[model samples]
Target: MTIACILVILPFCLALAAFSDLFTMTIPNRISAILLAAFIVVAPLAGFGMGEISLHIAAAAVVFVVCFCLFAASVMGGGDAKLLTASAVWFGLDASLVDFLVYVSIFGGLLTLAVLLLRRQENAILASGIPVPQLLLTAKKIPYGIAIAMGGFAAYPSSPLMEAAFRATFVTTA
Candidate 1:
């Protein structure tokens, strides 16, 4: 029970840290290291056993390779790639890479929309003779940890909830 709780909470907290870093365009190594360490500890406990664990590790490796390639092409940040790979360690094979990528795309779209709207507002203010910062010129890059965190949050813990409910239902029979 305690392990389950830790597994659930730690990722959520790390997601928040990631979000903050993404917002500020800074990926704090401390937070990234902590997340990686947590996965190293928690993966074995997730009970897929050794072969399954290897598969999960492979999934993470794939994520690393794919995302790193994107980063190298200048399509994504290195931090985002590392964070996604670390997230894959926890996600495992049950969660398809396609779905993970979908979640990221959806979240990225939302973030882009929000920033665009904010930029528009800034433009309007400047046009109306109101003092405003040059948002287009001075806007900091979105850290992207926010989107990764969102994906991780969506991927986590609903499985455990379902498992618990299923166990309760079969308790008397078992």
Candidate 2:
């Protein structure tokens, strides 16, 4: 049961957020809520102690502060900020968190570049009836949730909770 939760929750949430942002230009609050709530429930089952869980919450707080500043500056959408903040808890303040952030940066840059290139060909694509999401072609804001999701998938295995879950699953199964 714990292994199932660990395997499904974060990845499913991230993927859903990415697709929702891609097509609708918004991520629903429920995705973030589910992620945060699931972590609260599953962290202990995965063998994280109080201190480690505190660190995870601290990471989320730190990410929230940074994301809040970006939202205030109009540099990031509210949904994006919330998603990043919620996702940060899985990594805590460890090297995995650093890896997650780095992946986010790289993916964000690449996604931005791809979006820009697509926009440059927007007129042609529009004429050709390729059926891309209209928001992808016209929105001023990038769907940063896509980058966040990509980064989350890339770095999630290194997260401590995931490692603990893996160990637990292997020990039980073996």
Candidate 3:
């Protein structure tokens, strides 16, 4: 239970900071460092034993490599990639990590759509309020930290109620 709490809270806090920094275009090293350290410490703890420890390490490596590739393509900010990799390392091949990432993607897509709509609204408001065309030239970057937090929240229900519900429905269908 304690570990589960840590797993949920740590990501949410880091994500809040990240979202703030992303909007301001500043990346703090402290939060990123803590995330990295936490992973190194917790991965072994999450493991069942020696055999599972190896899997954790492997998951970390996989996440790192994937982040590196995203960074190389410039699709992701360096800080974003770093934090994501650190979170994945901490999670260490767990189902929770899978759920977290899946929700992250879903939330990210929603965020993008909202940002686009906001951009359009901002353009219309600015156009009517100001005479300058250059004011529209600046594009706002979406702060992704909030999306991460949303993902964490969506995944953090501790009860096995979802699983039980699924089973109940499955029995009905059968």
Q: How many residue pairs clash in each candidate?
A: 1, 0, 0
Query: Stretches of candidate 2 above 4 Å error?
Result: none
lDDT of 3 by residue, 30-69 (tens): 6667766654554444434666656656766787798799
lDDT of 1 by residue, 10-50 (tens): 46655666655644665666666666677566545544467
Candidate 3 residues lying further than 4 Å off, grouped into runs, are: 1-9, 42-50, 124-140, 156-174
Q: Indicate which candidate wins on lDDT.
A: 2
Full ranking by TM-score:
2, 1, 3
For model 3, what is the C-alpha lDDT against the true structure?
Answer: 0.60
Off by over 4 Å in 1: 1-6, 123-137, 158-174
TM-scores of all predicted structures: 0.74, 0.98, 0.67
* Candidate 1 positional error at 171, Å: 8.1
User: How close to the true structure is residue 38 of candidate 2, measured as C-alpha lDDT?
Assistant: 94
RMSD (Cα, Å) for all candidates, in order, is 4.5, 0.8, 7.6
